[model samples]
Target: MKTMIVIPARLASSRLSEKLLLRAAGKSILQHTYEAAKRAAITDSIIVAADDPRIVAEVDSFGGEARLTSVDCQSGTDRLAEIALMHSDVDLFVNVQGDEPEISPATIDAVARLLATRPDADIATAAFPILDESKLHDPACVKVVMGANDRAILFSRASVPHVRDGITPAHLQASPPIFWQHIGLYAYRRDFLLWFATQPAGRLEQLEKLEQLRAIEAGKTIVVTAIESSPPGIDTLEDFREFVARIENQ
Candidate 1:
């Protein structure tokens, strides 16, 4: 199956404001993400599905391929749909969010591999065991409830599978793990993206502000690949600053 990586970059960001254009270690965040995606062994083809000419220009500056998508696209996956329409030859598309400059290439590979291996699955995503009690309660850290065979039952910002009695350190440190922090990285089949674009946003998706839930609510099978951990995405000025500090310190 032909696979490609698409980094959906919207120039306007609610938290950090044009954060993809923000530079760290002499590279724009979009470029950093693009380069990181390129490092993944899954596929060599990478495109930045940009919502603005500025983002296209930025990609051009890095000698990377980019296509201008409609600004009206609601989510990153929607932006990738636009690219999917253009590249019919590609069967699978991996979404590595432009904000995630520090995203792991292994995580990218894992998601792609999972989707490629599972014909029953419509989408494949990565998640890591959440060892921290604080992250379980923090809405910022999305939690995934897994059912069986690595299939995701649900994705929510709220703490789920509510320990009923209580959550203890043992629950957090369980062998199989009771809590998982969902990563934004995803590998979507071409047909899934096409069908997803035509469908209106699901109720659960809008309520949680998570695009993946739209598919979940629609009864699409989403498989999850367990990863060790994930690097932080740049969502705010503080996140960008911390990323810069880490890069500079490196």
Candidate 2:
């Protein structure tokens, strides 16, 4: 199947304020994310599905392909849907958010491979085992509950796979974890991408503010693969500062 990675970039962000355009180590965050996505060995096609001409210009500055999508698109997936319509030849489209400059190419490849390998799954995503007790309960850390054989049962901001009894450190150290922190990276089949765009907002999705839940509520099978934890996306000035510090230190 032909696979391509599409990054949805918008100039306006509530949290960080045009954070994708923010420069770190002399490169914009979107450019860093685009560069990282290009590192995946399985595929070479990559483009930014930008919401503004400014983002398109930025992509052009780096010789990266970009298409201006509607700013009114409901979500990043919706932005990808616009690109999907333009590229009917692509069988698989990977949605990599622009803010995720630290997104792992291995993780991107793994998610794409999972969808390719599993005929029953409609989508594939990555998650990391949550080993820290603090992170497990930190409502900010979204959790993934696995179902039968790689299927995801649910995604939640609250702690899940509810260990009814008191927990211990032993549980955290298991070969396979009982809890996993959901990663934002995703791979979607062409049909699934179009179908997702048509679906209405789901109740669970509305409550959790997680778009993946819309697919879950629609009964679409989603598979989750384990990957190394990637550094969190840039969300605030502090996150950008941390990224700058890491790059300068290196």
Candidate 3:
């Protein structure tokens, strides 16, 4: 399958203002993410789908390919859809968020490979087992409920597969994890991207603020790839400071 990685770079971040342009270790977050994507074993065809000219310039500063997408795009998936329209020859388009500077190449390969192997699935995404009860309850940590054959049943900000009787260590330690934290990474079949762009956000999606639920509500098959763990993306000033500290220590 012909695969391409697309980093959706948006200038207006709500949580942290212009977070992608924020520098750490002498490189902007977008540049770091692009460089990480380059290290992935998948096809080297990568592009930054930017909503601002400054973002395009930043990508160019680092010698990375970028195209200015419309600011009217509601979500990163929408941005990817615009790119899909232009690159019809690409079979699979991977959505690598521009904020994820520490995203693993193995995770990218895993998600892309899952989509390539599962013809029934319209999308493939990564998730890690959530062992901490606090994190499971935290709305900030999106949870992925998995159904049979590694298919995602639902995604939500609320705790799912709810321990009706009350939580237990055994449940958390089950062979097949009882809880999974959804990673932002996604791999979409070209058709899926085009289809997603045409549809309106689902009721559940609007409620939970999870874009993936829009697909699930539409009866789309989404496969989940289990990874051991993934580094958190930069969201707050504290997260950025921690990222910088990690880089300095390294």
Candidate 4:
């Protein structure tokens, strides 16, 4: 099964406009992400699914493959679906976020392999342990609950597995934790990718603003793999600056 990694990039970012074009460590963010995906062993090809011509040109300038997708694509998954439409030979599609310039190739390979092996699974994603107590409570940091066989039971912004016992919140924080942080990277089977494009957003999906919830609501299994670390994604100016500093230090 061939795995194709498609990075959905747009010039008009609400938080940081043209973030993919932003310079970090003397390389554009999109270029970094594309190169990182290329490093993954499981991927047969890496393509940029761009909604804007500027982003397309940027990818082309770096000698990277890019395709112009519909600007009407509401999300990354939607943009990837458009790319999938043109490439019928691809068996697996991996959605790599454009802001995740520091995304690990190992992490990408792990998720793609999981989907490739699990015939019953519709999607595969990655998660890492949330060591920070503050991040555990942060709604911006999505949480994922994994079940037997490493399948995701649910994903939400709210903290999961509420302590039923008389354990105080402070004490619970001090104790070893079972919570995990959700990573945005996703690998979907070709059939599921097409089905996902047609389905309407479910109630849970709308409430959580997570497109993955639609799959869960439809009884689709999502396998979650554990990763040691994930690099910080560029969402704000501070994040971009920190990424630059980290690259320079390296």
Best prediction by lDDT = 3
Candidate 2 C-alpha error for residue 42, in Å: 1.8
- Which candidate would rank higher by TM-score, 3 or 4? 3
List the candidate numbers ranked by TM-score, top first.
Answer: 3, 1, 2, 4
Cα misplacement distance, residue 248 of candidate 2 (Å): 1.3
Candidate 3: pairs in clash: none
Best-matching candidate per TM-score: 3
Model 4, which residues run further than 4 Å from truth? 165-177
What is the lDDT, from 0 to 100, of the residue 127 in candidate 4? 92
The local distance difference test score of model 1 is 0.92
Would you list the C-alpha lDDT of every candidate in the order shown? 0.92, 0.91, 0.94, 0.89
TM per candidate: 0.98, 0.97, 0.98, 0.95
In lDDT terms, how accurate is model 3? 0.94
Off by over 4 Å in 3: none
Q: Supply the TM-score for candidate 1.
A: 0.98
* lDDT tens digits, residue span 1-250, model 1: 8899999998988788999999888999998899889999998599999989999999999999999988789888899999999989998999988999988888898899999999999999999999989998999999999998999999999998799899999999999988999998899999999899889989998899988888998999999999988999999899999999999999
lDDT of 2 by residue, 1-250 (tens): 8999999998999878999999988899999999999999767599899888999999999999999998679889999999999989998999999999988888899999999999999999999988899998887889999988889999999888878896689888877788899988899999999999989999999999999999999999999998868788998999999998987898
Order by lDDT, highest first: 3, 1, 2, 4
